[model samples]
Target: MNTLNNHENTNILDLPNEMLFAIMNKLSKINVLYSLVDVNRQFDQLIIDSFYIHDLDLTRKSLSGDISPIDKQTLDRIICGKILPRINDKVNKLTVEPLSIERIFHAVDYAQLYSLSLVNFSQEILLRHIIDNAVIHRLMTEQITCLNIQVSDKIRSDFSVKNHSNILSLILFIRENLNDLTFSHWFIGLGLTFFMYKLSSTSCVSSTLTKLSIFVNTFDDCLFLLDRRLESLSTLIINIVQIFDTSANIDNTKLPQLKCFSLASYQRTCSYDSRIVPLLRRMPNIEELTLFLSVIRMESTYIDGIHLHDEILIHVPRLDKLLFSITTILYNINAKIELPSNDDIQRGFIEKEIYQADSYVINDPSK
Candidate 1:
């Protein structure tokens, strides 16, 4: 009787605004908007506030990397209903699965949206977005600054060499307006060679592009962008593998604005440093650099019996921060990364943003 009376006496609406926002932050914003929007006048007004409705995730994903879209009934109700109209203007980032992306875009216009995260889209849909479509024209109205594409397993499995070439062409098309680009979970297929060929042949570039993170067929594929003279590029995280049979040579390309760079090797190679030193030499303005290798034997002598740090600093004159990491490739196709602590940290480098499990400390870029 006392508990029931206490609950009745202290209503949730009586809480302070800050306390209410703090409680709501723990729950999904999507669920919050669905549940509390029509509760009362005060609730409706609060849901549309900039603090609660800036970034909207229209779909949810599981830990094992599966995208679970919202149910169609609820989705249709939300779209035909008053929710989107109420807060559409406040949305800055919209993350949506492909199934509902078209409908969501047509439902309402986001005046302030700048970031679009496209998840699990098929090759056909990806191509559609690139062509002369309503989505492209509508999207161009806003100054799009970022594009995050997560390729679905089905798409990767079905994409042939020609299909993947189309995907690369789409990337080049959309990259003109994008400042930051990120792609997740790429499947290695023979088709990538043709895609790389297209990228290397193209001179089309983005002056606004500043950051890029992608997986490529070979080190030459990664260097294709640098050779094109992407002048505004500042940060890059590339998964690179050097194919021994392929002709890999560093051009006279220079990234004058590049400040941070990270490299991930997909295969085990005995000559990691020998191949990498020339690549670093091209980035004259790099202040922070990270190298992720599949295997590293530190006890062995480096080139010309020189210390690795001295050789790297000699090549990249502006490099003051670096992360040197090694990862183990397992039989199950899973990777186990172990960052050894021997030289870079012993010389007084500190750990910055960790990529995988264990990470090597790096020199400070601010210095």
Candidate 2:
């Protein structure tokens, strides 16, 4: 019996590095680091590998179905006391929430850190801990190359103008060494959704930024972000809350460097011809385009493949990929207008030699 038990029992250290790494990949980085670090000389050397320490997510992991409760005391003790100090230099990317942000940054100065993700931080905490703090500001401006910001606060009923200015200031502040950015703030509750952001006229004029994804309040706001000052911007993705004609005519500079563009808006626009078509024409050399738009047609029929081909595709000679989800809401004001069937939409696609197409038409008399 003793001999049989000895044969069945195998030490984890006996596993090869490849096998150990595969096993460690299954657990959260925190769990892996906490459970494995300081076990012995071999485990310490193994856990120090860049694969284990490169991207450290310090935020609390989602606890949907775990049987054991997270021991915050133990986690704080292990991470702050043991793990971060040893692996700080190897960390290239770090993600943190409000609770752990100060503690994590205070433990050590990550010399090789280039990317940072701030999640679920309130405006107050963000301003006090990160934005206004001198050390964090220097780290962001001098070292960070990629940044992602997601605010947790909901829009107040009496949303103050100071709050708007603070947001704009925050965006302007984090503009020195960044190459990629994704900034979004939205809250969905009580059968309502809010995503309100408008770029200021004096936005960042960076030559190094290559990709940007942001949420804007209006189509004009979207146009504001596509400033000629962003000389090296090659990819732009925007989710607009509303789409409409601008009140004033702005600069219509050709974006030759913009190789890819994606625009999504849930609200409907009646002026697709005047506003949206002209906007697409600005990107004369675009290679890839994606649009998710709702059109409220007042006098015209649905915007089909032919309209896209003539209006958008004809302008961009290099466009090799196109993906769109367009919905046209038709309303009869004076007379019953004839609307195209799904077959008609498909025929248009076939005529354009666009084989990959999915079209649907829904008629709602209530609207």
Candidate 3:
């Protein structure tokens, strides 16, 4: 009876605004708005507040770690029917998967929206909506400043590389104020599949984009993007499927405006010295640099701090932050050469003032 009385006397409305927000933060925006919006005048007013309505994620997450579009019933009754119609102007960012995208966009105009993420749309479906749908096309060209595209499994089954290329061209050229962009797809077992795009002389260029995160097929494709066409680009994050030595014919101008760079290659490469080192040498004004690489056949020498200091770090004088995860696998090991210990690797980094670096040695006797 005492416990029952305590529960009955406690009122959630007595909690402060911060406490209410904290509770809402633990719940989905959809659930918070749907459950609280019509409960009372106070709850309705709270749902309309900028803190609650500014960034809306309309995707449903499963316990198995899959993300999909919200169901039609919730979209109809709560989001489109009640919430969006009430606070569309306050929404600054919106994320939607394929199933809910058309319905939500057709329901109301997010006039204040600047960031949009379209997830799990196939190349065809994505382009059809952006190119054929007048409202979506207008939103992309006129309003959106940041866009993230995560293509669906349809991309894997579809063999039309032209459609993929067209998607890239449309995004880079048509968007008006787009400052940041991420365009990639995740493969089921193989990991990220880098799309191959060939830039052309007649292709339209974007003057507003400052940041880009993309996946490409080759190192030469990286060169094609840095060809002064994206004149305002100051930050680049790229993942290459394969890194190989490129011909010296491409433009090799210094990237003075590039302030940050991140390069990740899941595949092992032998061209770190030939291709990667020279590429890092181009970014003279880089304030931050990150490298994730798996290197093979390095003439039996690991890429220790000494090799990093001598080949790469010394060249970039302005760089203040360096984060790297590099693995070098040697072949044809000589029995006479004594392999460096984990302690020896630490000393190399300590001598260069990189005291936080860590190292370990893994030897596969069967290999």
Candidate 4:
């Protein structure tokens, strides 16, 4: 054991600089490398020369917080001189928080690249500045190929209008670039008429988008916003939460190329709305279906007796794999059922029979 330990230690010490650099890249966290930089001058030089600093994580390091002017200048120099050039070709993903659009634009301009994501960005001026400015226009025209915009409904009412215009301009930009796009946090009560209008009006859209995911706060919003046809999309994932009242029917004829579909709902009450049945029946090639009901309050007689059984299981016949997860909490009114286990519902009635027949045919056809 002592000889093996000594040999391993010697090998680590004798490892080539290139091998050490590769190992450092695989550490998976920046803090580990930071620690190694403190160990020896050789390692410090390795870290600095590798230009790993090109991936600036301003949010993670809290560099946006108030700082001394000298420190800020020094950081800016490091980013502009050492980081930006290395990132010119290699960096593709950029995430910006809602704090300040000016900071985001400044960073993006310095980076001279696109494929950006704005998370919970509620400020209108920042968005307007991007759309109105020439520098951003050039950047979007040349470099941007993927865009993600996230809006939170908890902000002030005015934020919604700002978000709407920003989305309109963003959609227009994507229509021009034909980029892969994702829209998160599609809350209810936000006027989506403008979006719908633009989507319907686009004549020769050349979007390279192959995947689209939308998260809606209510089923009504999902039905409304998702009612349009996306001719080029090949994969779609929809997540709805806390509200299941829908009158609009899904139009699947618009999405003929869809090969993957995922539907998930959590902490919400559900019912057997007749509109959803036809929608499920229309998705003829769906390979997987997952149903998750969590922290559901069972009060409405519409959901309790026969609706859940009929609406959830009896529909969606094309699903090759079905998964169900349910969670409920007891209250003073009645003893509520706990969350269902991983094995609660083995298979729906038809699924079980199909599985048995397939198993018998595969194992013993003569029998």
Number of the predicted model whose lDDT against the real structure is largest? 3
Cα lDDT tens digits for candidate 4, 47-90 = 65625533433333335642112134433555444444444454
Model 3: per-residue Cα lDDT over 78-172, one tens digit each? 88987888888999998898888888999998999999999878777898898898988999989999999987553354454566667877987
State the lDDT at 226 in candidate 4.
38
Q: Record all residue pairs in model 2 with backbone atoms less than 3 Å apart, i.e. clashing.
A: none
Q: CA lDDT of 87 in candidate 3?
A: 88
Two-way TM-score contest, 2 vs 3, winner: 3
Candidate 4 whole-model C-alpha lDDT, 0 to 1: 0.49
Q: Output the lDDT of residue 57, model 1.
A: 82
Please provide TM-scores, in order, for all candidate models, with all chains considered together: 0.76, 0.82, 0.90, 0.61
- Give lDDT tens digits, candidate 1, residues 45-143: 667788877878887667686778777777778743668887888899888887777678877878788988887776567667756566655574346
Identify the runs in model 2 with alpha carbons over 4 angstroms from their true place: 1-26, 36-47, 63-72, 155-164, 167-174, 187-200, 332-338, 363-367
- Clashing residue pairs for model 1: none
Candidate 3 regions exceeding 4 Å error are 1-11, 155-159, 186-204, 246-251, 332-338, 364-367
Off by over 4 Å in 1: 1-16, 155-159, 184-200, 241-245, 296-299, 302-306, 327-367
At residue 267, give the lDDT of candidate 4: 48
Ranking by TM-score: 3, 2, 1, 4
User: How many clashing pairs per prediction, in order?
Assistant: 0, 0, 0, 1
Give the whole-model CA lDDT for all candidates, comma-separated.
0.65, 0.76, 0.82, 0.49
True-structure RMSD for candidate 2 = 4.2
Candidates by lDDT, descending order: 3, 2, 1, 4
